[model samples]
Target chain A: MENTTSNQTAQNDLQVLRTSSLTGALERELEHLILTGELKPGERLNEIQLSSRFGTSRGPLREATRSLQAKGLVDAIRNRGVFVRSISPKEALEIYDIRAALFGLAGRLLTDMVTDAMLARLNEFLDEMDEIAQQRDFDRYYPVNLQFHDFLIRSTNSSMLAQEYKSLVNRLHLCRARGLVQAGGLAVSNHEHREMVDALASGNRERAQEAFFRHVERSKQRFTTTLEK
Target chain B: MENTTSNQTAQNDLQVLRTSSLTGALERELEHLILTGELKPGERLNEIQLSSRFGTSRGPLREATRSLQAKGLVDAIRNRGVFVRSISPKEALEIYDIRAALFGLAGRLLTDMVTDAMLARLNEFLDEMDEIAQQRDFDRYYPVNLQFHDFLIRSTNSSMLAQEYKSLVNRLHLCRARGLVQAGGLAVSNHEHREMVDALASGNRERAQEAFFRHVERSKQRFTTTLEK
Candidate 1:
């Protein structure tokens, strides 16, 4: 009897673990759909269809959807259904403003905290980004640029800031799936990236913050102008 | 046949509306419990008990808890249960820094946009807050101060900013249930509020931003000092 109870408890633990991991995987897959535009903005999610497509039951699927909804990727409407959020142009611009503030905060935080190792990593990314920008290889430069900014925020060692920053960036990605990688935009953006690194290396907190803030503001302008055209 | 179909549709709509509204009420009630510290940080939520206590079914109760979990009020464990999130002091201070940045952004946004009516409303808040501070009426001052900040952020005409600001404020509230308000803290804080309004009225965007940012930083310092004591 004791053995049976212990085995049952172990099985229960495994089931719980499996459920949680499945939910996480499901959430990521759905996020990929929304972020990559496979599921377009304002497209209603069909629960039954998605359940069969993912080969999962409704319980885990709902959990995943709820998590995404919380992250601002999906909107749940009463009696209606969950739909991919369609961010307005105004909201997109507002998001940029908030992102600029976050970047500014990260820059300021990094001013007195960037170690030699951290500086070297940032320099490496700057060089990588510069090369890709010169070649106009957006596919490679985009992730590198993201990495640079991510490194800036993460180095602050503030989990809340990093979490909020990631969520904001994800929503912004939903704003422009392919991103604002125009013909000459990549080169100009990387140049600003260089300025940010230079400002940080100069050990001037205010200048670093301003550089990071302005970098995002310029990108916002570029995106807005492109979106209008 | 048409009458029957239309009646059925109406009933379905009513059911949906009731469910949604009930879930919303439940959410607010749960929020009240958490915010008031009745739920206590890190306390595991009992869904079965909560459902019965709220006089609702498991379905709507789950919906309510899920929403709160998304808002960062509650944390959902994989299999154990959801618990009230206990924020660390470090996390609280980091929250303050982000809040400062957000307030700074709101101040800058307000610089070129403050209307006479808006200025009048802000002035009313300032005067009311000053009076409450003098009277040492914290109960009255707390909500007034919150409204003042809410008005400040909302006046920027950015819903995304407003939403994120509110979320940050809520998490900050979770940091301290009784707040950082002390005997003389109210009066000193209101003076800073006056400076923010003056800066806004001056229409110098940079100064306004600085004033707002510093105001939050000062509050952070006060809160940390109080929390330590």
Candidate 2:
């Protein structure tokens, strides 16, 4: 009887771990959905529908909604339900301002911590970006550009900074579907990326900071210009 | 029958709004608990227990947990339950680095956006801080110091920056319990606050930025010294 109870306890622990991992996976999926604009802003999330769609039970679905709510991606109403958060123009500008500060810090830290190996990896990524830019492959280039920024942020080796940066970038991604359609911005973006990488390679902290700021400012300009039309 | 059906719909909508507001309040409470260290790191947050403590039901309690998880305050495992997040010395340092960058931005923006009324209000707050410092009332001065930084950030009128700043401050509060202990740092802190406010009042961006950086460095020094001992 003692042996059986011990085995049962071990089995129960494994089951708990599995469920937690499953919940985490579900949360990530929902995060992607919101960040990628699969679920548009202000769209209501029906738990029952989502559970059926994901082939899960309501338990995980509810948990995922809670996760998203914490991330500022969704708003939970008392009895009603959760809905995707809508970003206003004012909110967008505010987000960009904070992003600029974060990227500025990342650039400075990146310069301070640069290694030849890291530069080479950055160059490899930039070359891929160059090819995509030449082909005007906005779809493919967008994700690559994001990866480059992510790489630099992670390279800084500051997890807190990276975590906050990730949230800002995710929010920006949600707004990208509406903003990245600007004319002639793609080439400028690629050029900015090149300049930024050069600044990092040279270990010029001031220039690196400027380059990153300029890149974000240019994106903001593009966004505003699109909104104007 | 139609009247009854419409009434039911109205009731459901009301319930949703109520749930959202309740969840919001719950999030704030949980955040306070985590930041104030009332909830110890790695402590289990059982839903049933939390619900009873907060006088809420399981639904809102779970929702609050999700929000905290997103903020990196708590980790929820499947059948096991949620636990408060734990940080090490390395993580604490990383968080301080991020705070430096963020508060640096706030400083620059505060200089650029300073208004006459804001300066007056800041001066008023500074006088109060001076009085508290003279009295060696760290308890009163502690919150005033936070408000000085908070006021500066809010005056920038950048909600997103304020939100990110609040998060970093919350994390710092959790890590070291800064300003909670009765130390002789209040005098230096008051002097720094005066310098920061004066720099802002003068609309000298570079000076303000330097002062802000110095202020943050001083705080970090205090925290590190305390942690070392």
Clash statistics: count for each candidate: 0, 7
Misplaced by over 4 Å in model 1 are A1-21, A176-183, B1-22, B176-183
CAPRI-style quality class for the chain A–B interface of candidate 1: acceptable
Q: Highest DockQ: which candidate?
A: 2
TM-score (chain A) of candidate 1?
Answer: 0.85
DockQ of 1: 0.43
lDDT by residue for model 1 (A48-76), tens: 99999988888777767777887799988
Clashing pairs in 2: A77-B19, A77-B20, A78-B19, A78-B20, A79-B15, A79-B16, A80-B16
**Per-residue lDDT of B120 in model 1:** 93
After superposition, the stretches of candidate 2 with alpha carbons farther than 4 Å from their true spots are A1-19, A127-137, A181-183, A198-207, B1-22, B55-57, B176-184, B201-210
RMSD of each: 6.2, 7.4
Worst 10 residues of 1 chain B by lDDT: B175-184
Error of 2 at B66 (Å): 1.8
After aligning candidate 1 to the native by TM-score, how far in Å is the CA of A132 from where it should be? Answer: 2.2
Q: Could you tell me which residue pairs clash in candidate 1?
A: none
Q: For model 2 chain A, give the 10-residue run with minimal summed lDDT.
A: A174-183
Residue B103 CA error for candidate 1 (Å)? 0.9
Predicted chain B of candidate 1, TM-score versus the true chain B = 0.84
